[model samples]
Target: MSEGAATAATVATAAGTAPLRERNGGQILVEQLRIQGVKRVFLVPGESYLPCIDALHDHQDAIQPIVCRQESGAGYMAEAHGKLTGEPGICFVTRGPGATNASIAVHTAYQDSTPMILFVGQVGNDFAEREAFQEIDYRRMFGQMAKWVAQIDRTERIPEFIARAFAVATSGRPGPVVLALPEDTLWGKASVPDMPRYQRARSAPAPAALDALQTLLAGARRPFLLVGGSGWTAAALRDLETFAERFDLPVGVAWRRLECFDNHHANYAGHVGWGMDDALRARIRDADLLIAVGTRMGEATTEGYTLVQSPLPRQTLVHVYPDAGELGRVFRAELPIAADVVSFAAAAAALRPAAEPAWRGLARAAHAGFLAHQQARPAPGPLNLDRAACVVRERLPRDACLTVGAGNYALFPHTYYRFQGPGTSLAPTVGSMGYGLPAAISAKLEYPQRTVVCYAGDGCFQMNLQELGVAMQYRLGIVLLVFNNGMWGTIRAHQEREFPGRTIALEFDNPDFAALVRAYRGHGEVVQSDAEFGPALERALAFAQEHSLPALIEMRYEADGIAPGQTLSGIRAAALAQRAPAAVP
Candidate 1:
């Protein structure tokens, strides 16, 4: 046959209707998500979700299914994807243990304000009253954390319910949405409606609030800006950068929101709390007006509920948030506006007045000082936390995404790396371990074009070590760098310093991480000596490219016996001083 004839025949075959009916419940649910622009779905398998899995396979071109090892890991990966793409991350899991395991990531998304959709399989109608295997009330259990939760009892309601769930999840106060798909209903048949596509809702800031913010900006002798969280869109970030530059105002990023601005920006003043330098902090304290956008300015970000030693007596705080409850929940605010972050920022930028010469000059000098301090900070030695960050930052592709687990190992990435894109880095601020590997694999699945790396410590990685097989099974090209300190470094630092010579149960005898990775049919290597670090990293990256599988690089470094901000001895001595009396002269 001629080439053209062969192409025509192939097109005819491919264009035919699906083998199954359009009324299939699982297919409808998947189609609803497709219409909403969701392209990836991460999951762990179980009997309850067999129907949903079948439907996902039926619509494979529209929604990609990423299988994971653990339910929590799947959720973490989905959260990371949502952060990166500004699209609702979809994840599927079975009921009971599966639902409970996935619940943690819901809280993670809620706290982070990440947009995600979780599809959980529930017991069949026949087993609901009999306590069927792996069955639990996910709706009630996840209600507190999710923006929306529903159990689909009928196949016909799948389209409407899921469309509503996405709207609620991605609208104001974006967070996780849970949808429970009953197994029997998924297998059952009904007419699937072609629901209207989901559209994100954005509201403009209130006129009164906009006028009030403008008035403050025009009248202030010293004004500051605090940017926080992932709610701000790229255009909003650009507007903020421009506004700060135009007015010469020093901007303070919320603690752990390094991705909000380039660390090298001239108008940047370091973080508001959590190891922020005293000098820059003092400068922020002196500001007469504070503009907070898209951030709760919560306890952790405020350094245990205090921005300064004492609240600025005359400072006017204008907080802008998507959630009404988060406003003025921590500190008193002169003006609290409930509006979409990006829209509000755009409006504020348009109305902002020109900066006075004197105030602009002061802010310029403050920004310069901040840059000097950043440069003056010492680098961690080879095999140290700083070196690991430096290597990855310099060598990794500019667009690569990273997943970092909670521990001392995470501190370096938080403090050292500068993120240029949204969702460039993923980590649980509430301090959850065992998230790094799974999140990395999830990122890779969501964005196959970019490199993905997960930074984890010995103790943290051990908690979810089984995920390595998931990486192999899917042929995920992720790089896993294990910081092998052989102890729960954060807690150990405290115990060693506070209780000198006292052995605590915080230490661990680590398995050979390299051997474990190799056992899973992936490349593995150890970097213990200074000279071997560069070579080992090169080999690992090469392995990732050659085999298109996960690569594990175990890096060993000497324990500095120090916490992130204080020495172990310093903490212990502080405790001792509080307990002991001064010597009598």
Candidate 2:
């Protein structure tokens, strides 16, 4: 597969003006990716995609493939890449086992609205109905999670499929797409012209819709802005901030979307997700006008549809999104504007407020509540996870990237740290547990100079801990802080709340994570108290930066201290008291 062959073959095909050359499906697919500006690919090698790997060997100038330790890790790295870049993070895996392993990140991408593409190497076409080894119908398996799923049969259609994959993955309500490549099809050859690169189709808000939004705001006593989901450009975020500043509207970021807005902004409110501050939640519930942009207002953000009622919210709702289908799917909107973030934000910035905002005090109070929420008190443990989060925020540069997987521990960083934009945060809104480590690795790989830190719980870290080997292999100097409490904190809190002391499979013992990091040929440390943390962190960062290797600090904490200002035993005691006959009433 040489460019010279493509150029020298001047015999144009009968159907087109451009010359066509005999190229295998793998070569064509890779070339098409090159034309689409794919700089890197994440994958775990398999025999099914051997031809593609062979093509990669010759076309090294086009794309750099990062080999991962497991299919899941590869998929996660790709998902993180997508979150950071707003492009389709590409992943390649083999048939059944590989595809199944990679499905976790695919689900995260789907729920988080990140653009990504997963390429699975399928069985030969000859074995279509025989249920061959390592074979599964991806179209059926990934149909629900992915925006589109299909298999490439004819080699000639490779370019067409690739182009459409990019377009669909980046279009409205951007999500993951799956494309399966049959082994036989990839090995076959065809003389065909390449399809041009795909561009994201943008939709702007109609003028009347903008007018209705301004009218709604003008009439309201209180209005709020909630931003999240995906397909957001930096310019869009700037314009959104401009709109908020002009209207003096309170802005709250959706779950795991700290990147959506600058936390330091005066109009910024507290995090609007699970375990949100009571003050902010009440403010949202009481707002007269709610302008929700980009976010789908999922269960986490809406507190199980209680904050803003489904079907018909009590507050007048102005929903803005790239896709129209999601506008009325759950909550009916007074004004539904189907426009991409870029366009909607631009329009919003340009619109003149009908009057001076009546909700200035409300916005100021919301920002105050957000600031107060960041202040952490002592927990029932030696290690102050919240203080450690503050340490990372203070010591690291404002541009440093922070990654966290889902756990009770994640709440600390979500609460304490201030995010600048997309470059600073990598978290899974769908609450996937093993996302942090790989996401940190991906961030470091993408931005080698930026400081990268990962926060994970004992249970969450163990889920994809083996990926440490991949980080060590790549010499990615990422610092990891493992909050070890010997239990899955989130479930323990819930279990204590519902059943008191009946803890079952949720409790588990963990290995020495510091030793595990050492075994992986990276720097390691143990910090159990507040005094040991700062010094240990400094050492870890110094080691990682100087040695160009990963570093881990195992910060041990008490199991009873489940969350900030919350204890498991206290919860159990409260539950038991509630269960014991309600005062004979």
Per TM-score, the best of the predicted structures is 2
Worst 10 residues of 1 by lDDT: 372-381
Q: In every candidate, how many clashes are there? A: 2, 0
Expressed as tens digits, the lDDT of each residue in 448-483 for candidate 2 is 998999999988888889899888888899999998
Candidate 2 Cα lDDT to native: 0.89
445-540: candidate 1 lDDT, tens digit per residue: 767777888899998898788888788988887889998877888887656556754757876788888999999888899887657867787888
Best by lDDT: 2
User: Runs in model 1 with CA error above 4 Å?
Assistant: 1-22, 308-314, 355-357, 373-382, 494-503, 561-566
